[model samples]
Target: MKQDLVVDSDEALNRKMYLVNNALDEIGFTWCHAKLFMLAGFGYSVDSQLDAIQSSVKVVVDRQFGIDFPVATQIFYVGLLVGAAFWGFSADIIGRKLAFNLSLLLAAVFRPYYWWNELVSHLLAFGAGGNIATDVTIFLEFSPAKYTWLTTFMAAFWGVGQTVAVLVAWAFVPSHLCLAGTPCPSSENRGWRYCWYTNSGIVLGLALLRLFWFDMNESPKFLVSNGRDAEAVATLHAIANKHERLCSLTLEELLDCGEVKDAHDFKTNGYTVKSVFSAAVAHVKVLFCSKKIAYLSTLIFLSWTLIGLCYSTFFNFVYIYIQLHGGNTSGSTYITYRNTSISQFVGIFGPVLAAYMVTFKRLGRRGTMAIGAIITMGILFGYTTVRTQLQDAVFASLTYFFINIYFACLCAYTPEVFPAIARATGGALGVLFSRVGGIFTPLIYYYGLKSGSSVPIWVCGAVIGFLGFIALLLPFEPTRFRSV
Candidate 1:
């Protein structure tokens, strides 16, 4: 009887999750889900917002600070690395609601941060970068399993944010920047400040929308794992009430499953920290439950790391190269921002196509990811050989489109591959490694890259191609498989 009970443990817990998913699926897609998608995507949007803002203002920033490279972007990457640690653990400790909004508020309310611009910029970056994973996790919990592809499709917000940032930059930087061989002092160049102010206003508005526009619920699993079975059931019923659907799940049924032992769970010995650590250990053990999952996790983590390094080293600096080093007279700052806006707008479609292609049985998520990565790598290699402005635009646009395709698949795929019990732990660790890899970009810029040299671009392409091969090695493909 004891052995039989042990065998039924995971099965019984999964039964609980199955019921919750059923309740969510029955509610179907509504304005609620749509609103949640857009709102949760704010986190995704802010990430690219900061990236686009910093990259577009690189010239002015470099000039303003008397630096060679834009250190703000580098500092942003460092913030992402450090911020991950705090955000990862805090969500579970303090309720997700405060933690989520607090991060956005911290980022937005920096108008008084004039004492030290660079220091405050990194802090703002920290606030924005930290909420990314939290946003994805929250949305996934509310998502109907059938529409899981929306997770990838939601990446469209990233492009939207980036395009808007570039447009703002274009509006301000063209007539305000210090041109090559032209004197540009802080008094003369107000464009970068305008860009920062505009971005901060936009972010502040998002925080307000998140706070007042939508009322978010605590994740059902979070409640279940904490022995709040009644609340978990009530939360599901509330969503069904809003959507006019009948949920068949009952509080007693959830209680019948015994203690929730699945996702966001801990093995409690009535010891606080030790229990949490044990829960994390159990989560990690489950991630490597088999050779298949083990290999896939390693490949996924490695893929993220390479992507972080390669993308930061290439894309972050590619615009500067196009503006300053390309052949002929098209290297003007105005033309660079204009072309960048176009490229960003075109990249918005990549995630859409990725969402569709991932459902293909022959290709599935793994094939889509592999194909996108390889094509993007090829495009990056082609970018190195472009000699004219038109060629640069075409190559750069294609690279953004395919990189978004690859990236959308990755963001969706990582969450899908990990079991619920270990999903958060594995996903956080993956982002942590990616940011760790990204921090080396500044080091490369400091040590290896030279102005007008395409060596780093070429190396980035080579590493990405290697990552494409690694994408194929991911053994567990969660195409039609529902994440538990």
Candidate 2:
């Protein structure tokens, strides 16, 4: 673990490892671009259901099935809750790239159920949640220290997804919406179906690109943590070779320390149920082993939970709420969809702004995240007070713009705080808690709507603001603590 210990034995090998580290950074910059392509596609796929709703896919489902639309959104979150935890554990055990590819493929396979049963279609939502856990973990692992900030930038593609969905709806849904309270003739209700088909095509293409186009190596940090020093060294050298560079790193150099050998010997035993449980327990211990990490992890869990509540409740039902509250002035369904598009377009700047703000000497990561959260809370409260369609559109747009920034920072910050060995575990747990909140959001939204249209908005605002204050209590600033 100490560079000096290795240097005393063979100065030349130490220098070679240093050069290998540099080469890894160069390769990361190139690989980071490829990962972005995949992340962008994955982002697009993850939001497909929302795109469907904004595009009047909900109208088709509501008209045909006679089911309340909110119930359908809640079912999707049910799948999401299962998938997020399952894939998070899978990525840590099966390896990131394999888990990464499988999540998208699974989602694509489940997408066609849009035709037969509304409940079955949410199976795609389950896969999409899995994709989120894997995509963020994979991107974080591959990014070099100097450019780790790129993780937040990758979230901008999420906005791209939202925009693409809206554009597709604009092109197809305006002319094709089934009239409300009537049987939606399947043959004529082609707009939402077309959107699903296009979304599936994009996901399928992304899966192939990840499998065939990108020759990504296993994470060297992961290998080192797992006591696979030989593979770690080889991976580093392979990265150098792929980038047309040279590295003098050898397996012996990597294994020079006796500590690593002792660790490797301890890990060589065959797998067992007890061992699996022990490993899970050990990861939990590591996450909260220190007071600083305990505070950080606990607050992050709460923040993610609140985010889930806000994201599911607002995003799934905002368009409908606007229609109900301001329908007289909300214009046609097309204009409401257009308003969604315009908001997403404005949201494109959220991550870009966060990318810069996170680097500021004064603001850094936590400061920026705190500021974004506070602003978002204010916007959420303001959103409840809008009287006209124009006011609703403007406030809602600002709410998302700032919330996206907070979300980006949270994604970027979560993995950075954990060590390489437990990064996936920590992230997955956060998603698990978040999804638990998501699982309840629809029920809350349903009952809140019964109570009053503004009830959910007020509750979401108060909770978001309270959670933001809690996050401010996180003991360590990951940017300052790790520099990654």
Candidate 3:
């Protein structure tokens, strides 16, 4: 997926991408957009909930398994990093469809093992990484340029996901939790398993909906880049048909512009294993083919890493921190989880507000992101002043609210920044770096605990605050139409 229009030259590829972009802009928002939004956004929902379960249930699992160290999240990040690199590279080589549906399906099917078993979390993390990596790209490929802002709203599902996770934990965990300092069998206190089971069924249902009911075609951009103009046009027309609208793009017009890259030309070229590896390398090259793109990609990679660290530090260990601070004494386990649910619920507004914030002539995506990050950092610093559980909940809620604004904007901005062909590859790398930072989060927490419990929050908050200034350095302001 190096160049568009199956063209031999980058110039021709850009021209054809422009044409395809025009045709899609004419389609505007439609039923296909709506359907893809939900399915793709469901990917976000599942990802957050997956993370939620990991954090919320870790203490319970620790007591049950007699684990002294919290390594589940660290192992999960390793799987996430590997998955991002592997599936992301393949998404461009094959298509987004396989990675999209396959990730969730793997999560659902791979859930039979014990929760503490590293294999279970790793497999699920791999699926989560792959799907979250491409879900935005698929949605962006379908969306008309005019509706790009709507992409900001998709992150709202993240709030929904964490909320669901918190509620699930609330319902079963409080009553069945193993006592501290006691190693118990799963039979005595495994309410976390019920939470996992419920979420697995939910993930499975969404996977089925996407795999069978939804006609999730390959990305039109991916198809066009691979020299499959006819298929691209057919996919476009199919969407038009679903919307009962007319599309004027034809294979002849597309091909008339220029020849396309014959990516699937297995007859002429056997598409050896070398081709797959080459495809990955080629996509990475395309992502940084220009000085402008190189600088942008570099900063973005750093941004992802920074955000990943901040998110993992706060969310992954917040529950444990709260528990140690007399979370039960603060108001009982029910209150702790109820506060979590409330925080996540309010966090939903973050993305919704971001949707409107991006449309402002001044804030745009970058400004909104910076503002969100800086504000969240302030909340983090102020959180140390909280001497009560109510203050902790309030600070936690504010943290989610502001950081989500940054997160939603980041998700929307990444796909638009990368070229159509390298979109998935670029995104996967971004997610990979984030997971890289996440892998270190446990060590950060461990050392912070050695010095003082509050030190991790200070470090994470400052890094994110610094990330805000970095956001301002990004020169690209995506246009209302296809800028890539």
Candidate maximizing lDDT: 3
TM-scores for candidates 1 onward, in order: 0.90, 0.86, 0.93
Each candidate's lDDT (Cα)? Answer: 0.74, 0.65, 0.80
**Alpha-carbon lDDT of model 3:** 0.80
Q: Which candidate is the best by TM-score?
A: 3
Candidate with more favorable, higher TM-score: 1 or 3: 3
Off by over 4 Å in 1: 1-9, 92-95, 109-115, 180-183, 261-286, 317-330, 447-453
Ranking by TM-score: 3, 1, 2
**Model 1: pairs clashing at backbone N, Cα or C within 3 Å:** none
lDDT of candidate 1 over 1-484, digit per residue (tens): 0011011136656667666777777777778789888988888888788767876776677775677755766777777776665665455534355666777777764422233667887788778765665677667777777788888888888888899899999999888776666676777788888888898999999999999999888877556645667878888889889878878888888878777554443323243776666666765676676676778778888988888898878875564455456454256778878888898999988999999998776887788888888898788887766767788778878988998888888888886766444455566667777888888887676554357577788888888888778878877666656666
Residue-wise C-alpha lDDT for candidate 3, range 1-484, written one tens digit per residue: 1122221237656777777887788777887789889999988998888888888887787677776667887888898898888888888877888888888887764343455467889988888877667998889888877778878989999999899988999998998777776667777786877888888888899889998878788888888878878889999998888788878888887787786543443324656887777777888887777777788889999999999988988765554455555543246777878888898999999999999999885888999999999999999888666667778778888999999999999888888878777888898999899999889878876665554476677788899999899889986766333544
How many pairs of residues in model 3 come into backbone collision?
Answer: 4
Error of 3 at 9 (Å): 8.1
Give candidate 1's TM-score: 0.90
Which candidate would rank higher by TM-score, 2 or 3? 3
lDDT of 2 by residue, 1-484 (tens): 1121120122333343343445456565665456554553464345443434433466565565566636666666667777777777656655666667677776664233343444555666666776655676666655555666777776777777777777777777778767776667767677776776776776677777777777767766556555677777887777667666656656766566433211221246755777665665665666786666677778888888888888777765554465566544357778878887888788878988998888775776777788888888788877765667687678867987888888888877777776655667777888878888887866766665555577677677777677667657766565543321
Q: How close is candidate 3 to the true structure, as a TM-score?
A: 0.93
